[model samples]
Target: MQAPELVERMLRGDRRAVARTISLVENAAPQLREIMAGLAPHTGRARIVGLTGSPGVGKSTSTNALVKALRARDESVAVLAVDPSSPFSGGALLGDRVRMQEHATDGGVFIRSMASRGHLGGLSWATPHALRVLDAAGFGVILVETVGVGQAEVDIARHADTTVVLCAPGMGDSVQAAKAGVLEIADIFVVNKADREGARVTARELRQMVGQVEHGPGEWKPPIVSTVAAKGEGIDELLGRLDEHHAHLTATGEADRRRFARAREEIEAIVMSTLRARLGDVHGHAALDKLADAVATGHGDPYSAADTLLAALDT
Candidate 1:
């Protein structure tokens, strides 16, 4: 398909266009560069909110409820649910959207499931590219949910205007926020399933963790909100806190600084990837193949051979 037609369809809010654009970005197809370049100006209008937490915290349920609420207010919403597939198999179990009841044909809301494609932090590297597409496509709100919790999913902080960390009671509640590096980035902390017992204790633990962190520039403290996502309880308060954090970011220019930094990092990675692609063409893969065989056989040191090959690539 021609690029212009595809872009036009995207502007029309065509679902196929959304999928196609994301695929183009994910594959890093050089041909889509021109299309994305034109689409860049349409981005930045959407407010991105990232929701994340450990397993079984009703994050998906909460996300669906929130999207439904916004849609009720006549807002256009887009949900990018990023899930990681098992490395052994090459498919995703991105089933979070299934719990989102009654919004399939709502027209005001768009929900698309995404696999991480093995990117670090359980987010595909092309995710920012997809975000740009959605931003340009004019979705008023975009929510990014990531909960792959071993290493502090800090990438969400880089992408979202406000980061929300969700927690629940009846578990190792005290360390929930602290252990995931979430205590640092969360602008708003939510103790979901708040109707359950131990809700107050969980909230207290999160508050203590937040208190220990050195107040960042502008020194606005993080607020903890309790919610029962299943029944839509406290969602308004959650949304209000989200807005407050966004206002703080805007008032202090922290938002712009973070966006600029994220753009720089993404652009640098793209440039290096392009350079590496150019390297293979210049070095000739067949010759490099023989060099690889030689190195494996102990006939040549991998470093010197790689240096020689890379030097040729510069030319």
Candidate 2:
């Protein structure tokens, strides 16, 4: 089907259409621009929640539990599980989808696994666009699960409305989060596998860590919620906290501000990518190579060469 027809079908809640659009985005197909333009007007309705952390923190399990909780409240949900790329096929490893298979048959739930494709920061480069497709497809809540790459996974904070960083007992996650600056990006922290030993210690350390940061008056404090996701424990409280955070964002007008920032980042990313591609075009590359040779031989400074390149692009 054509891009416009596919978008219309997606907006009408056709799962197949949604899947096809996402695939187009993931592959960076030639028709992507048309598809995004068609879906643009229907976007911005879904709540984008990001889940991230180190491996073995129960991110997948917590995500599944959270889906059940949302469904119980009659919310239609879509999950974008970003997994590591398979070295051979350059496709998603599919581990997360396998773990979340319980919801596969639910009409209200749509689950897709996207390969990170060597993109750092734990997300596929196509994630934001895929999210737009899902939002336009009429899902009320979209959960984005990032690849569990320690430290570098904090990029989701820019794309998600509510960023939930998960940790587990004895994992040294709190220390890692502090070092990686994930603590500052988190809007909520979940200590999953709470039934395990050292659960309270983990919670206490997180609270203490959060307390060390200074916040302006009325700033939303990230709450530390505990959960045993495998047994579905504390899922209700987790959902409640997410709802409370959403309400806070709306009440404080931060929701609009956050979304605006997200759009700005997306636009900037696209522009940079386009510029890079333009720089690598045949004619541009010939000029770039001469400039590089000049710089390497000390005939020109790097900054001047960069400026010249930019000036050429302007013409």
Candidate 3:
């Protein structure tokens, strides 16, 4: 279908159109500009939530449980499960469709697995665009589940309105979270596998850590909720906390600020990507190569090389 038709279908909540549009985004198809333009006016309606944590933390299971809760509330949800990339084909290593089979047939739920494509941040570069498509497709809530992230891979905070960090008991994840600076990025900390032996200790550690942060009067403090996600335990409390955080964001005007920042970053990323593409052009590439050769031989400096490349790109 044409971009206009696709956008219309997507806005009308057509699942096929939503999938096709996201595919276009993932592949960086030429139709994106027109499609994004058409979809832009319909976005900003969905509530975006991001889930990230270490491996074996039940992130997927927690996400599955969350989807069930949201569906019970009669809300439509889209799950963007980002998986590690396959080295050979750059495809998503894990198929979320298999893990989330219960929701596969639910019209109110749309689940897609996207490869991170070697992005060190644990999220695909196309994530923002894919989110826009889902939001415009009329999903009430969008869940972004990142690949198992390590220290410095907490980019999910930049993309979502609410960020949930999950940790399982007995994994030393609580300490790892502190060391990784994830403590600062998390709006909600979950101790999944709460039925495990060390679950209470893990939750206590997170609470103590959170309490150490000095928040002024109305500042939101991250809460530690324990859950056995595999059995859908404590999911209700998790949902309640999500609601409370959303309300806090609205009451404090932080929601608008976050959305503005998200938009600014999205625009900047697009510009950077476009510039990189331009710099890969024939003239720009040749100019850069010549500069590199000169710099290597000590005939040209690195600064001058960059200047020449910029000039070539401008031309």
Candidate 4:
């Protein structure tokens, strides 16, 4: 079907159109550039918050809790939970949809699971397209949740208007948070299971870490919140903070700056993905396969392989 036709249907709030648009974006359709241009005008208006943590730190649970709280405030929320890409099949794990069962019947809440699909470091090339559909469809809040693995945690803050990093007791992630790159990206630190034995200790370490950072005058201090997401404990307080942060951004003229950064990152993701698609297998299969073999054999330099891809651009 034509891009305009699909876009018109999506503007009319057709569920099928919305799903179809998202599918096209996910697959990086050749016509996607045309589709996005049409949808651009309908974008913005959704508060995109990124929730991220290690796989077991209850990122999804907290996300569900936040969505519920937002709905209670009469806000329509869209949750896009992200999963890792499959190495062999390149498909998303899609566990978030199955886990967010309670919101299945709620029309006000739209939930979707996305995958990096080997688009590393929180790569969300199709996110702008998806968010555009939701924004046009009338969602007031958009939550992008990522499984905080590797250096991808930093990427979340880049996408979100306000980022909340989730950490729980017994995760041995205190220093790891400082090193995992989560600490730098978080505007707020959450000790997810406040009732746990070492919640306070975890909070203290985080607080100290935050204190050590030198900031310009009037910098917003990141607050450490404690919550038990399963029973909805502390959910209200967390939502309150989200509201406060959003308000601060708008009041201080920082919203424009934050949106600028988010836009750039989103555009970079799209451009990079599109370029990669246009040039399939950037590193020839043989070179990449051999590079993997070389790493295994400790004979070939991975850096040379990277240099090779750049050099190929000149060829």
Candidate 2, superposed: residue stretches over 4 Å from native: 84-91, 96-100, 118-125, 149-152, 282-315
1-315 per-residue lDDT for model 4 (tens digits): 899998788777676677677777666677777877877887777788888887688888898889888888889888876554342442433565475567777777877766545545234766666766778766789898876566556666766788898888988997677886776788888889888899989989989999888866777778888999988999998888888888888888887898787788778877776666544556557766766787779886788866766676556
TM-score result, candidate 2:
0.88
lDDT of candidate 1?
0.77
Q: Report the C-alpha lDDT of model 2 over 23-91, residue by residue, as the tens digit.
A: 887677878789888888888888999999887998888998999899999999999887553424634
lDDT of 3 by residue, 1-315 (tens): 999999999989999999898888767889999999998898888999999998799888899999999999999999987655342463442456476577767899998877645353322347888999999999999999987666324667888899999999999879867888888889999999999998989999999899988989899999899899999999999999999999999999998999898888788877877767777873645677888999999998999888877776677
Candidate 4 clashes between residue pairs 3 or more apart in a chain or in different chains: none
How would the candidate models be sorted by TM-score, starting from the highest? Answer: 3, 2, 1, 4
Q: How far is candidate 3 from the true structure (C-alpha RMSD, Å)?
A: 2.6
Q: What's the CA error at residue 134 for candidate 1, in Å?
A: 0.5
C-alpha lDDT score of every prediction, in listed order: 0.77, 0.83, 0.84, 0.76
- Worst 10-residue lDDT window for candidate 2 reads 116-125
Candidates 2 and 3 compared by lDDT, better number: 3
Candidate 1 backbone collisions, by pair: none
- Pairs clashing within candidate 3: none
How far out, in Å, is residue 34 in model 4?
A: 2.1
Using alpha carbons, what is the TM-score of model 4?
0.83
Question: Of the candidates shown, which would achieve the greatest TM-score relative to the real structure?
Answer: 3
* RMSD, one per candidate, in order: 3.1, 3.0, 2.6, 3.6
TM-score of each: 0.87, 0.88, 0.91, 0.83
Best by lDDT: 3
Q: What does candidate 3 score on TM?
A: 0.91
